[model samples]
Target chain A: AQSVTQLDSQVPVFEEAPVELRCNYSSSVSVYLFWYVQYPNQGLQLLLKYLSGSTLVKGINGFEAEFNKSQTSFHLRKPSVHISDTAEYFCAVSKGNTGFQKLVFGTGTRLLVSP
Target chain B: DAGITQSPRHKVTETGTPVTLRCHQTENHRYMYWYRQDPGHGLRLIHYSYGVKDTDKGEVSDGYSVSRSKTEDFLLTLESATSSQTSVYFCAINTAQGREETQYFGPGTRLLVL
Candidate 1:
């Protein structure tokens, strides 16, 4: 079984400021980690994913995340944010094997970017 | 959403009514999934289909049923709508590509159960 936990429920940051959204997971088997973003009244869009080999992965919109296996964490970060960056972010996990592609997601963190 | 379309983008219904939401995909992916999103709960899988006529339950499948008679269409049915079932419904598709189990989602259906 796999589960994801996003530490923050909401994060408010000024424009051009750096921000980080923390995520942690628990799984008995090797898993694939992903980050998705959802704008108001829309479905989730894949921001990035970590399958193997790379601990630091860069994603769209100048965002990036580091997969720390020792800490069981995959924290999303952006050096600078814009007002348009305000959205709900979700962290998800799935088994690394060839099993069913069932993704377990976190509760989500709402990012608020103000000018 | 990548070629995925969920019908009746928004719906309002009363209790005891039967509602079915349709999801269509032109990508011809082999896997389709139904998930409901709510505040503080993220997305919970309702049901999923691997192929036509092959459906299985998910974590939150008690009040939902799913059917897939054709490769391009997957339907999620609520036998009896309830206030507790009011949430944003999203449909997703997964291809058999590589070891990466990436899923593309639809625009979503906002279902308000009164």
Candidate 2:
């Protein structure tokens, strides 16, 4: 069984400021991690994913996340944010080895970028 | 961009009514999923289909049923609508290319149960 925890329900940051959204997961086996973003009144869009190899992965809209195995965390970050970047971010995990792709998602973190 | 579209983008109904949401895809992907999004709870899978006529329940499948008679179409039906079931329903398709697997979502259907 795998579960995801996103502690921050809402994060507020000024424009051009750096922001980080924390995500932690618990799993008995290796898993695949993913970050998705959803704008108002829209479905989720894939931001990035960590399957293997590099711990640091870059995604669209100048977003990146680091997969820290030791801490069981996959935190998303952006050096600078824009007002347009305000959206809801979700962290998900699925069993790596299992053929089935069932995603367990976190509650989500709402990012508010104000100028 | 996965050529997925959901029918009746928004709907409203009263309790005890039967509602069915349709998901149509042109990608011909083998896997399709139904998920509901609500305030604070994120998205919860209602059901999924690996292929035509092959469907399985997900974490929150108690009040919903799904059907897939053709590769391009997947339908999710609510037997009896309730206020608790009103939510934003999304349809997604899973595509696996070599070692890469991704799920593309549709615009979503907003259902308001009165």
Candidate 3:
């Protein structure tokens, strides 16, 4: 079985400051990782994904994450944040090399970028 | 944004009533999924369909029943609405030809069971 854990339930950051949302997963087999963002009243949008090569994956709105296999982690980062970036960010994983379509999601980290 | 539309964007239904939520896609994608979002729980998968008439249950499929009669349509029916079923329902599609494509989500349907 595959599972994901996002330690931070809520993160408060001032505008223009960098922030990181921590995520870790546990799986016995090869996996796929993903980040999704949900704005107020909107459905989730794919931020980025890690399928194979390149430990570092870049996503929309200047967001990026690194895949650390040894650590079993995929942490999302943004050098500078904007108030518009305030949203709930979710980290997820799928088992094996398929679409990882049947995803197991984390509890989520609400990034509150204050102006 | 992948030509996905979730009907009855908002609804208030009573207990014991049957409700069906419709998901229509214009992109002709082969996969469709239904998920419900609740406070602090993130999105829980209710059901998924890889093709017409081919459906599978997900982690939270106990109260949900789904059907896909055509390539462009997938429906989720709540046999009996309950307060616990009140949630924001989303429909997503996987369009990537090879891998599980990044899911493109519909606007979402807000159902309030009172």
Candidate 4:
């Protein structure tokens, strides 16, 4: 079985300030990690994914995450955030060998950006 | 944006009534999935289909039944709707091109059981 944990339920930041949302996972086998963003009253959209590549993976909207295998962490980061960036972010993991993709997602972290 | 659409984007029904949600895809993807989203539990898989008439249960399949009669259509049904079953439902398709696999989602259907 695989599971994901997002420690922060909510993160508050001022406009133009940097932000980081923490995520950790537990899996018996190797895993693939992903970040998704959901705006109010909308479906989730993929931010980025860490398949089998360099630790650092860059995503749209100038967001990035680093995959730390030893630590079992894939934290999303942004140099600066805008009010429009306020949304719920989710971290998901899938077993690499499953053949079919079955995603297990974290509770979610609400990013609240203010002026 | 994988050409996925869920019917009855918003539905309201009473408890004990039966409800069926439809998920349609324009592409002939072999794999399709259904999920439910709540406040604390990000999203939980309800059911999935690998091919026409080939369906499997997911983590939260206790109160849900699914059927896939065609490659582009999947249906999820609640035999008896309950208040606890009220949540946002999403449909996804696995677009696996070679080794790159990603699930594209539908806009979602919000169900309210009173």
Candidate 5:
């Protein structure tokens, strides 16, 4: 069975400071990794995704995630986060060839940005 | 911005009563999905539809049923609402334009069963 693990349930960071949300997955076959953000009272919005390409992938809002094959990790990072960046982050995984049939998700990490 | 909408953004129902949630998409995507979000479980799939009238169960489809009679609308129903079924439900569409399938979510519907 495939599963995703997000170690931290919540991460607090000072505004304008760098932030990193860690995610790891376990799967027998190749998989696609994705990061999503959900603001309060809103649905999830796609951050970035790793299909088949370079290990480093950049996304919206100056965010980036590095897909480490050997470590089985896809960590989301941002050089400087704003107050508006405060949201719950989720890590999801899907089977490589499956066309959105199943998308296993993590428990989610709440990013609290303080001024 | 896939133009997905879930009806009855908030609802309160009693146990043993039947409840149905509707998901409508303007994008006309081929694949639609229903998922529930709980405190510790994140988002778990309940059911999905591949096309009109082609539906299948998901990981957490024990007490839920779904129907898709058109490309734009997918409905999820609970035969008998339970307290455990009180959660936020989301609708998603598989809007894959390439090898990678990307899902766009709708503003969730919050259901509370007492």
Candidate 6:
């Protein structure tokens, strides 16, 4: 079985400041990791994903996440943030053997970009 | 969008009433899933279908029942509306075999059970 834990429930950052939203997962099998973003009253949009190979993966809106096997973490980061970036973020994973498509998600992290 | 559309956009109902939400898709990707979004819980899968008449339970499937009679339509029914079930519902589609399962979601249906 696979489960995810989002360390922070909320993160507030000033505009143009760097921010990181931490995520950790537990799974005995190989897994694919992903990050998604949701704006107010809107559906979720895929930010990025890590399938294989690289530990560092870049995503839309200048967002990125690093897949650290040792920490069992895939923390999302952005070097600089904008007020428009305020939204809810989710981290999800799917087992590799079963299929890299069916996802199990973390609770959530609410990003508040303040100017 | 992945050609996904959820019906009624927003609904308000009282407890004990039966309500059904419809999800329509034009993508024909084969995998359709129903998920609920809450304040703290990002998104929890209620049910998913691999193909017509093929369905499976997901993490939070107890109060929800799903059916897919055709490729383009998937339905989610709430037998008895409850305040606990009040949340935004999202329908997603994934072409797992080809696109590697990055799902595209619908706008969502906001149901308020009072």
lDDT of each: 0.93, 0.94, 0.91, 0.94, 0.94, 0.90
Q: Pairs clashing in candidate 2? A: none
Q: How far out, in Å, is residue A3 in model 2?
A: 0.7
Q: Worst lDDT window (10 residues) for model 6 chain A?
A: A95-104
DockQ of each: 0.67, 0.62, 0.59, 0.62, 0.70, 0.57
Considering only N, C-alpha and C atoms within 3 Å, which residue pairs clash in candidate 6? none
Candidate 4, residues B3-89, lDDT tens digits: the string is 999998999999999999999999899889999999999999999999999999999999899999889999999999999999999
Q: Against the true structure, what is model 2's DockQ?
A: 0.62
Cα deviation of B56 in candidate 1 (Å)? Answer: 0.2
Candidate 4, superposed: residue stretches over 4 Å from native: A97-99
Comparing 1 and 3 on lDDT, the stronger one: 1
Please give the TM-score that candidate 1 achieves against the real structure.
0.97
* Chain A TM-score relative to the true structure, per candidate: 0.96, 0.97, 0.96, 0.96, 0.96, 0.95
The positional error of residue B76 in candidate 4, measured at the CA in angstroms, is: 0.5
Give per-residue CA lDDT, model 5, range B1-114, as digits (tens): 999999999999999999999999987799999999999899999999999999999999999999999999999999999999999999999887666579889999999999
Q: Which residue pairs show backbone clashes in model 4?
A: none
Residue by residue across A63-100, what tens digits does model 6's lDDT show?
Answer: 99999999999999999999999999999998742322
Q: State residue A17's C-alpha deviation in candidate 2, in Å.
A: 0.3
Q: Is the docking of candidate 2 incorrect, acceptable, medium or high quality?
A: medium
Candidate 5 error regions (>4 Å):
none
lDDT of 1 by residue, A5-113 (tens): 9989999999999999999999988889999999999999999999888799999999999999989999999999999999999999988434468999999999999
Q: Which regions in candidate 6 have their CA more than 4 angstroms from the true location?
A: A96-100, B96-99
For candidate 1, lDDT tens digit of each residue in B2-51? 79999999999999999999999997888889999999999999999989
Candidate 6 lDDT, tens digit per residue, B1-113? Answer: 47788998999999999999999998777888899988877788999998999999998998889999999999999999899999999998884535456777899999999
